[model samples]
Target: MIVIQAKLIFLNQEDKQIVLDLMRRWSSCMKFAYKRLLEGYDRKTLKRDLQGMFDLNSRYVDDAIMKARSTLESARELGKSPKKVIFGGRDLFGKLQKRHINGKAYEKLKIRWQEKRKGNLYSRGDKSKKGNLNTRIEVRKNGTFLRINVGERKYVYARIEAGYKKNKRREELLQEIAESNIPYSVELKLKNGNIYAYFAIEEEYPEIKITKEKGVIGIDINAHPGNISWTEVDEKGNLISYGNMPMPELASGSKDKREYFRWQYAHEIIEIAKKKNKAIVIEELEIKDKGKRGDFSGRKSRRIRHSFSYKSLLSKIKTLAKREGIEVIEVNPSYTSIIGMLKYAPQYMITKDISAAYVIARRGLGLQEEIPDNYMKFLNALTVEELEELKEHVKKTVRNKHLKKKHLREINKAIKFLQSLESEPERVLKPLYGTSFSTYDFWRVLKVAVVTPLSPEKVPRDFSTLKELLIQGKWGDP
Candidate 1:
């Protein structure tokens, strides 16, 4: 959607007062609708009652309800209670409550607060209603004017003074509005003693042409390290290029500034895809609430988990890719990093992040992964009794650290994979490698038995030393 804002010039004080009164009534209706929605009222039921309950017409009431519903949904997404929300401005409300200022300053604050509390009017677009029903724009020879239906066949007119020069999006929208029966939503807002009209129109996304026929760029977003790693692969599944970019701004910045960086990075990534004539591939990362009220995950871990906006960055990438007509492929995120660490990292002498990107690219092209022979042999070297010993050792570490229950499940999974490898290796191998012994199972077991004991806090980024350990079949002193 594209939004264009324009300043409204009232013809006289009477028209301005009429607009203000309408805004006040509209905002009050919105608050009423929001309260009803919170009390289990549906849209149709509220739509029927709001027209009769409020002094406004049906169209205005509907728009108020729509705006209220949007605000309520936003509150819910942030895990905030709608009842606790202050409609105007929470900061201004607090200041006024505390009586922080006096005389002219206090009067100014109160007016601003009133404007925020009662300064919104919205009109949804309709093709049948000539772009908009209640609020329609007429571009006349004298000047552009807005015709707003107040109520009972009464209307108020205001002149529009918005520049569209040099703005291709807005220029195109004006042309579309004039030539075709295109619908555009309008929101008239009163801010700082002036009226502004925001016009929003849906844009058609271009058709996707760039695809995996050439190859793909696999992206690995590492939240803990605050960097994004990517690997380019050819159609034949061979690595062409690989790189990493750090995002220190994401760690500390204003919300708008951080959003700017996100878009900048997204554009850069898509430009690479465009230059390579390839599709973009990334993990379909899903953030789950694994931390409970009494979990021993620690504050540092929770901060790292919450501070990073994994979905936000990924969303920006996908949105930009769509706009640029680049195809995007999302693969299962499970074990991509671990697979990269055990197999690709050591073999290719690359960092874990880049290796994971390589794996993602391969997966995008429908390529299957095979475990290395050394990793297979390393798993074969461990007996059932030794596997049991490693399991017990992992349990001891978890218990000593007071980790969550999920860690206990992970220890069990690793031990079971090893037990299967020690007994009927073919059972675990057939699905992954189509062979008698599952090679992939060995790496996971190796992670628990070998890697965890050496570095309990986190996985090492550099896996150069892992090559020798896997080759020599060293289960080490765990």
Candidate 2:
């Protein structure tokens, strides 16, 4: 019952110009839809509102509404510079792209990309103001080739053998695609002087297993404009290796090259996960302007928060993980950087980011960190007289005297504090005369949830629900 889907893309050169023309027309349609949105037309009513405007098919018009609606909504949510994601598709391609899964009324963007941002990249679409027919670009497929209707009964075909079936792994994918019964979608994309046919094929009866015993490879992502880091750890929270996998020192204006390098690292990580037969762990962080309105956190031109493309990296990890039969887990990112800064840097002898990544990996592994030095100072903050008074208070509480709940907790904290210094004279004496940190939040470390590292007596013994579901690709449906 596990349904998974992804794109199968290939270069389409025969009717590249025809598809490109359609893309431009699609962008025009999307802009018109954006104008209507700004005019207070809601998504549900766009069908009746802009009925004959684009002159596209009924379904294509719906597709425009969805795509345009999505484009505007995402721009608002992420505060991305581009409010208009000028993209196009119709009919089957429309259904597959899922241009707009969530529709909403979008606000006007002050900083819009008005074609002058990057030469003639978008100006051409603006000039091609004429509406396009629905049949200009059509999507169709059976068992052999994916056919696209360009114009005047002309069609372009993307053969499976010329694309995915050429690879050994993709050849298997083709077989699974042939046997699957679940629904699927296909698309055509024109990017940077190239055209790619994308098949969003669904995977039916997928096998998932959450493998135990095998240690996990916990990774910490540090995305920055000029500084990126990654750290790896085992299931026992033992450090295996760590360094900056997200390369920052790239040639200027080499976005594609930068992406290729990132793909390389992603590939290597998946290989590691596959070889070790373990799950991949990483943090889930969003990249956006979280500062006050119009006040993004950054320097003159360098925004640190915007630089953290943690979401994109996580997407790559998950996509590759699914392909390689590996598990991907995302954990909370709270305090990983702070804790790493305090203790991990000195202990691991690594740089700032690597230290943070080490802490991140251990956090993903569910390993409780050691008590920080500040906490120990706080534990020893109380004087001998105060300790004696606290001890007396504990005795008074047991004498049937009704006390507030806070009093009981304070008494328990006092007992736990005293136990740590019971046998050590230096620990008690130093605090008595020397300065110590004053705080009341010692439960931070004491109450941490932990999965004890595997040992002779610490193996996982619970498997009551193992047969119901399997993940990490260890076991699958027979």
* C-alpha lDDT values of all predictions: 0.78, 0.48
lDDT of 2 at 447: 18
Model 1 spans > 4 angstroms off? 81-83, 89-110, 163-176, 251-256, 283-312, 366-446, 469-478
Q: What tens digits encode model 1's per-residue C-alpha lDDT throughout 280-327?
A: 998774433334543324443354346567678888899889998999
Q: Which numbered prediction scores highest in TM-score against the true structure?
A: 1
* Candidate 2 error regions (>4 Å): 1-27, 38-40, 80-206, 209-213, 223-253, 294-311, 348-350, 366-478
Residues 194-292 of candidate 2 have per-residue lDDT tens digits of 444444443332354534236667666554434446665666777777656645533244667766766667788777667666677777644443454
Q: Indicate the worst ten consecutive residues by lDDT in candidate 2.
A: 118-127
Model 2 local distance difference test score: 0.48
Give the number of the best model, judged by lDDT: 1
